[model samples]
Target: MTIGKRLFNYALIYKKTIIFALLMLMVAVAADLAGPFIAKRMIDQHILGIDSYPWYETDEGENAVLYQDTWYKREDHFSVDDVKGKEVRVLQVGRDYVFVDQPVTTPEGERTYEDGTLTITRSNEEMSYPAVELTNDELLSFYMPEVDDLFKLILVYFALLVVASIFTYGQKFFLETSANRIIKKMRNDVFTHIQKLPIKYFDSLPAGKIVSRITNDTETIKELFVTVLATFVTSIIYITGIYIALFLLDVKLALICLVLVPILVVWIKFYRKYASKYNHIIRSRLSDINAMINESIQGMTIIQAFRRKSETKEEFEEINKDYFDNQNKLLRLNSLTSHNLVGVLRNIAFVALIWYFGGQSLTANSAISLGVLYAFVDYLNRLFQPITGLVNQLANLEQALVSSERVFELLDKDGTEVCEDKMPRYKGNVTFDKVSFGYKEGETVLHDISFEAKEGDTIALVGHTGSGKSSVMNLLSRFYDTKEGKILIDGQDINTIPVQMLRQHMAIVLQDPFLFTGTIASNVSLNDPMITREQVEKALQDVGADRLLKNLQNGYDEKVIEKGSTLSTGQRQLISFARALAFDPAVLILDEATANVDTETEKIIQDGLEVLKKGRTTFIIAHRLSTIKNANQILVLDRGRIVEQGNHDDLMQMRGKYYQMYQLQQGKQSSLAG
Candidate 1:
């Protein structure tokens, strides 16, 4: 099902609660109906009595049919008193404005209304008409029925009110819970899809923007479950109830009031269509701003180092301004268009309804009763009010659709492929036989490269800058697959081995090792959560960091600042070595591990490697030739091709690229010393 339908269907899930809430609404409306019914009773049976002949007729406006009312002037007033509010007629008899003052007393011998104001105050005697007087007869016969009925209705009103409160709270609780649950599931799916996406996708994607979509975008969608669902569902219920009540009370005037509804509905549909797009634009700009903020903050060090604060600030200001403009446009358009339509609808409906009821005096078979018509007029506006509100929520509804589509897009991404070998362990014997690979089209970094390293062998890779040394290492670890040719470990093609198993057998210590924010012990034991204190201490001792930790106030438990900024570069290198040693893999790859360490520390680390690589395969890439002199073999690469290979003494004898580099290094050292 579509997301909008799915969100709407959520209401059906809590059918019992919704039904109960509706029942409460019925009670509340019933209580509300009491006031009008009482007013009607007072007018019909009590005030007018059986002898009074009241009138009923029809009234129309500019569109009225002429033949219908052409014979008589359209009389629209129902006067209960004279111009002076007196219950008597003028005499001369009425041609000249003369007051009639008769000294006749009422049946109880009281006198009234002989002045200009015609004020009627009760005199010392009792009233004869129970219609005008309030007494025991009136109480039992008329007032009792109305009051008792209203009393019962008020009771039902409060009772249903409690029930409504229960369901209202239930609606809030379930909506929030369900919304949060769906968001959690969606967030996990988004993260999982991102991880599965290929490297090129990440390169092309804006890092901060993706993060905002997963976080802020998903949050915005979550609101739809409760906000739009509750609002629209309740509004529809109110609209339906109102229309039904009006029809049940007075169908003719009900029809008149309802004519305006279709017009409003079509207008709401149109306004909402445009409002949806503006809402999407506003939300998209918000996500864009979030992306920019994250990227700028993360790259602050680079921006500062390059003195790019002004450029970054301008970029940020531009995005923020766009976001503000879109937000204001969305909110303004939504409010003005919706409310203006509502005002026009309300004024026209009320005008039509009031005209119809006011001309109810001349109809033949008058089904019109004054009180019932009053009730209809009272409730007419409320019927469409909810629909107008529901119309306003269309913007939020559309935004949710966009977010859902974005989320599903991520779920469609393909994950990284796994290799064939499912073996949990391996004997380290790596070979690159005519392997060639590149990142992009028509550009190869490693060209027809070939090499071999048996179990327990350390093969050192030496090359000029940009000679594809790191590229070859990355290929061996399967960070990037070979475009052509093959790499083998033991007799099988490297691609035939599962990545997880291959990684378990190998460890890589990069030139600039990343140290996360955590205690020294936590960072080293990240891969193996089960690593004990003894293993951590041994690893630290092996890399000669334990002595340094012992001097610190908190020892291994001390917190490291982000990227280990509190420590020197050499200190972080020592920690990286310890972390790598803690893994105890079957194969080790050291890429410039000791390039930044002091001579004394470098010597200590070399001794540690000698003990650690007892029966494991190792790949060493170093700029300093002295560090890798004792490797089982050395491979000198020139322009992505292996130019020389042998033990240290054998390669020196060949006097090729490897020998020439060695001689150049020796001459530079001698020149520095002299």
Candidate 2:
């Protein structure tokens, strides 16, 4: 599915809230659009109604103005049953009201009153009528009948305004609430999906980049939901309301305004053409900057120690500058397209209105009413507001699209499902049959490797760097699946088992132990429900972590910060060892677990290793040959192949690569001692 459709699918999760918000929005728009029509009625029917001719003399007292000695009422105020006496006209000619006893043939012409006579002239034609001028007091009395009705209309308009305000608030509240909820669900899914992704997927991507996708990119998407979505929906509805109002007022002008819809569509297409490119670059650079910052923070010790601070600053500044430049480009595009485009289109609309209305006025009897003209102008002005809003939100729309694409791209990656099903513990019998693998295609990291370890056996793998020692452990742990051959555990192919369930009965302590930010006990137990407090304590005691951790005031409860930076290397390693032992795995793999510690700590860990390996098959990947001398079997790897395999005495008797490596390491120790 397209990114837009994917985003819409997410919105569908909360469709009810969005639908209700849209309904509220429509009501609010309807209420607000009623204002201009009410004003038209007020202006035409009440305020300007006095100029309407042919007042009838009526006997009814109500709405009847006593003019001179006669009771006169405007035709609109005359009741159906009222008795009529004589016809008269009250007309406004050049801001002065005149009382004409008899009606003129036509009221469209210019009028001049002189010497008790009213002369109407149109195109060299003239007619005259006997007239009388009324004072302000008399005119006020004539308008008294409309005062009550006008006040009522004003109240109605105010009530409509109040209704509009209330519904507007409702729409905004619901829309923002839905927006926050959508973003919350999306963030949770992204984080959850990250767990399902394979370790190799993270191998080529930086932690910082992934962090940016989850944090910065998702934040941009939230704005798309919160601000962009609301603005676009509201603006579209408002524009539609305005168009409908315009059509009610004048069809020809409304049809002319239809041109704006196409213009706006084309404008968005053009804007996105450039904006998308800039936004893609901007987002990519932002991820790069995040990655670089993360790497710098992680390696700050080396950076500062080597005095590469200036170089790192320059590198960061370069990426930051690129990001800034692209942002400025997007800003320029928005500035040129948003309000500026709306202003030009608004000017065009007004110019067209002037030309159309001006042409109408040129006809012999063509004249638009004041009320109709006022409402048209009002509706026209209102139309541009939504257009401006929509145009302004285009940048955010494009940005959100780019961010969504990134997020969805991550979500689309193939990931393993975390299975929670229980599998009965099997005997610790592992066998690798002609196994060969590589992280990438056509780049073999491990050659046809075969090995076997029976139950209760200790198998040690010793090799130089880049000699596939850790790769063998990785294959055993199923971090990466091998395509060439099969790995069996307890006579069953490891690939047939679920990764999570397979790992449930296995444990590994890495060369550089990683600890989370928690108490030392929690790190050992990993907050697993199966491992009780007693098991955690026993594991710690068995791993000799108590001896190293006892100096701290909290002892087993001592706080460990990120990556166990607050504790010593030996302390972190002991915690890792305790963690492995706490699980009591059927197969235990220790990958150079003692490579970074001092002799005393290694000796303490050696004792722990003896206990950890009992009655369980163990695979040890060690760089120090002395550490694995007591193993039942030792496999010495060269390149991607195991060159020699035997007991320590047998390897020494064979005088092969293992013997040479062991002699070299022993010679180095002897020289250091001398």
Candidate 3:
């Protein structure tokens, strides 16, 4: 599906609120558009109505003005059933009003009054009528009848304005509320999906890039919903309302203004074409910059130790400069297309209006009223406001679309569903039958790897670097699936079981143990309600963590920062060991778990391992030969294949690869001791 359709589906999640907001917006637009029409009415029928011809002499004094000892009412105020009387005229010649005793032909045309004669000059004809210019008091009497009606129109106009204001507020409130809710749900869904993704999926991706998608990209999409969505919807509605008002006033001129619609549509298409490319680059470079920053922070110690700060800054500047350049390009695009373009179009529209109204319409036989011209100018000005708004929002719209694409791409990845169903813990009898595995196609890292460990057996795997020690542990943990062979736990194929259920009975303590920001006890239990405080204390005690942690003021409650940086390597490893034991897994793997600690700490960990190995299958990968001397079975590996298989005494008797490795390690220890 297209990004727009996906975005629309998200909006459907809160359709009711959005629909109500739109309804309010429509009402607000209607109320606001009505102003021009109301002003036109006031201008044509009341303000300038005093110059309308055919005043009738009336005996009724209700709406009649007493002028020159005669009570005369404008033709608009006379009742249909009233008796007919001799016709009289009231005309505006220049700034003065002239009263004619007899009506003149052709009320519209250029008018002049001199020597008690009023002349109406048409294109080729002139007609004259005897006339008298009315004094200020007479003109005031003529306008007195419209005073109360004028005040009423003013009140109505303000009432419409108040209604518009209320509805506008309602629309904005509901629209923004719905927008916030949509973004909240989107962020939640994205974060949840990240949990279900396979561990291998993250092997090639940087943590910073993923963080950018969750935070920076999603923030851009929120602006789409909040600012871009509101602006586009409001601009379109206002433009439509203005067009309708224009057509109602004059169809010919309205059709001329209609030309702007296609022009704007074409302009938007042109803007987006270039804007999309620039925005995509900008967003990608931004992600790169974020990734670099996160990497630098993570490895700051190494960087400072190597004195590579200048080189690191230069590398960061390279990516930052690319991001800055793309931003400048987008800024230039916006400058060219937004208000500057709108100003040019507005000027063109006014030029057309002048040509149509001033050059032709005003001098024609059926000239438009001054009120129509005023309303047209007002509507024309109002029309460009929405256009300018829409143009200004184009950059945001493009940016939002790009960010949405990135977010949606992540959501579209195939992920395993988290199964919440519980299963009975299996007996820790594991078998890897002729397993051949590789991270990529046709590049096997483990070849024909076959092994079995019955329940409560301790199997040790010792190998040099790149000999697939960790790969074996990873396969056993189900972090990656084997394509070439079957991995079984208690005679059941692991592929058939849900991933979450398969790992429920297994745990690992890595060489570099990870700890979250919480108390040492909390990290031990991992906040699992099933792991009681007693269990946490027992697990810590079993793993010898309590002895070391008890020195702290808070004991088990002592705080741990990120990665447990404030704690010693031994403390962190002990906590990791406690965490693994607290879960009470049926199968446990320790991958170089004691390699980084001192001899004393290693001895404490070895004592804890004896307690942790009871009633559970254990696999140990260690380079230290002495660490695995008592294992039930040992597999010595080289170049992704097992070279020798036996216990330490048996392998030493063979005098093969395992024996050679042990002798070499013993020589190194003796030399270091000397």
Q: What is the C-alpha RMSD of each candidate to the true structure, in Å?
A: 11.3, 1.7, 1.6
Candidate 2 residue runs with Cα over 4 Å from true position = none
In model 1, how large is the Cα lDDT of residue 4? 60
Give lDDT: candidate 1, residue 196.
57
> Model-by-model lDDT, in order?
0.67, 0.91, 0.91
Clash pairs for candidate 3: none
lDDT tens digits, residue span 209-255, model 3: 99999999999999999989998999999999999999999898899
The TM-score obtained by model 1 is 0.75
Which 10 residues in a row give candidate 2 its minimum summed lDDT?
360-369
- Selected candidate, larger TM-score, 1 vs 2: 2
Distance from true position, residue 521, model 2, in Å?
Answer: 2.4
TM-score of each: 0.75, 0.97, 0.97
- State model 2's lDDT: 0.91
Candidate 1 structure quality by residue, lDDT tens digits, 6-59: 544654665665556555545444444444445555555433321122112323
Candidate 3 lDDT score at position 610: 91
Best-to-worst lDDT order? 3, 2, 1
